[model samples]
Target: MTGPAYAVLAGSLRARIVSGELAPGQRLPNEQELSVEFGVGRSTVREALRALASQDLIQTTRGVSGGSFVSVPTVRHLSAHLETGVALMAAAERVTVGQLMALRHLLEVPAAGEAAKHRTDEQLEDLRRAEFDPAVAVGEATYAANQDFHLVLLRATGNPLLEVITAPLFRVLATRFGRDHAPDGFWSCVADDHAELHDLVAARDADGAVTAMRRHLDHLTGAYQQMDRLSRAR
Candidate 1:
């Protein structure tokens, strides 16, 4: 049998949105108008709209001068969905820690070089704020700082798309395989690496930043692999 009528209508509307036939922020036709256009009942039109809203493809509002409109996907929205998908894949063993690290190496090393070239003064300060003294910070604070450093570094590249692509991967790795699995002194090593990376980027040393970032990721790869192994074995 075929899918429900609402699903079919939703698919048609989604195609329009994807093709840019319905531009972002462009209000959709009223339910009655949609019903007549699609040759479906008004209830089917509402259901289709609801399905689109749930997927972040459209938004609906109530009251006068309000109706459904196509959504403009933000980096945060896209990254959250990507984070969920990656987390699910990781949980199912389809994405391994090694694979995640490899992807990071591929993307972030070059991003570091770009950051060194394009980072603004404000971005450098943000990266500085992400650093912490492992001697003083422990547990969750350490993890947050480390995550922040990479996020700031990605943002410093003057490329929001890099953050859009890379932030979710960091999030999936951290959330899926808890940070508590690292060995003694791991945080300290991370602290040093982040500090060195910050300095290299601040100095606009593209080559140095690239080298430092690769080395930093290499240092953490073993810890992440250990965590993945432990998580799988359990």
Candidate 2:
């Protein structure tokens, strides 16, 4: 009962923050005020605040003028949480890393096919910019941009659920592998693949687009596996 109540209150507060009703950096009302406003006990408010703090959405400070305040969410925090879950799943052997990679390939291949059928010129332009920029480095920037390219593809699918599902996995993979370990030639290879995919999409060649995406994922899997092996050896 307490758990569900606390979750509800926390979710309500999170929604307010996401919706901008509680702007970032703004202090949350003190426990007494929140308890009165929510018609809940102070303990429940404290529980709810604890939940939000775990999500990196809020910070609690003590002393005079101290209270709960919204904090900017960082990708690193999100990635850390995601990596923990992925590690747990792997450790249980309920889901192997290979299985996860396969799932990604299955979803993304068809997604690329769908995108090829429905993608807009603007989305293609955005992808081109991310993939072809010569000034991008081989570390964090490259990894971030690589993730953005996939996100652009997912967005081109126009499926909100796909974005919601894949975004976390992408973040975890980026964090786990680290930017320096990402394939040095990632951008060039991905650019070539994207160009081929764009052509297939423009021509409404679903099969060709799917094939191109599969090939791209094949390269990614090989690179990731190689990096894993290197890390273990080290």
Candidate 3:
């Protein structure tokens, strides 16, 4: 199919999947059936399916009872789109990683303070577990849990808009500069910082929590800067 036709079909299919009209593991209509329904050729249906597959919304298999099936969205899929947008904004050179870190500092420091004033005991407990869980290693699982800790703080601010604004930044940071930009002990240090932040917030020491969070993020920013410098030196 042509680009516009392909887009229409892909979007329609994606809407169905997202709205739960077509669920995970559910089979999509066969190409012939879809073509007839959409009043398009089999080739058009195939092209649309290919587009959906690229977005990880569907997969195809060959054989009886095998066809296009909806696939579950994953964090990696979300992060990839965010990374692309960030890279575009960075324009390969004009926007330094330092600028991104500065933006984060500006938003997160005050948000942490607000969160301290507004957070509930349940939210703090969840953050505590995510930070101090002994079983978490320096791998994908640890990284995800760490991200969740920050997300909880953002949510605790009682500002849905702030959470939405910071979501993309977290995704970009995780995708581009996760553990690879930090030292082996970085995760452990973060765990300690998270614990302290939780304590400060739980005590309703808003200023203290804000300062702690700022210090922790500053350390992270410095680590990324060092990594950038080292890469340039190489």
Q: On residues 1-234, what C-alpha lDDT tens digit does candidate 2 reach at each position?
A: 245777989999999999999988999999999899989998999999999998889999999989999987564565567667876765565664466678789789899888877788898888776664535555666677778878888888887566656666656555554334555676677667767776777677878989999998898777777665565567
- lDDT (CA) per prediction: 0.89, 0.76, 0.79
Deviating ranges (above 4 Å) for candidate 2: 1-40, 49-84, 87-95, 133-137, 182-187
Candidate 3 positional error at 29, Å: 25
Number of the top candidate by lDDT?
Answer: 1
Ordering by TM-score = 1, 2, 3
Q: Which digits, one per residue and each the tens of the lDDT, describe model 1 over residues 148-181?
A: 8998889888888888889988888887875667
TM per model? Answer: 0.95, 0.65, 0.61
Model 2 pairs in collision: none
Q: Write the per-residue lDDT of candidate 3 for residues 40-86, one digit (tens) a residue.
A: 88888899999999888899999887899999655456656665777
Pick out the ten consecutive residues of candidate 2 with the lowest summed lDDT. 173-182
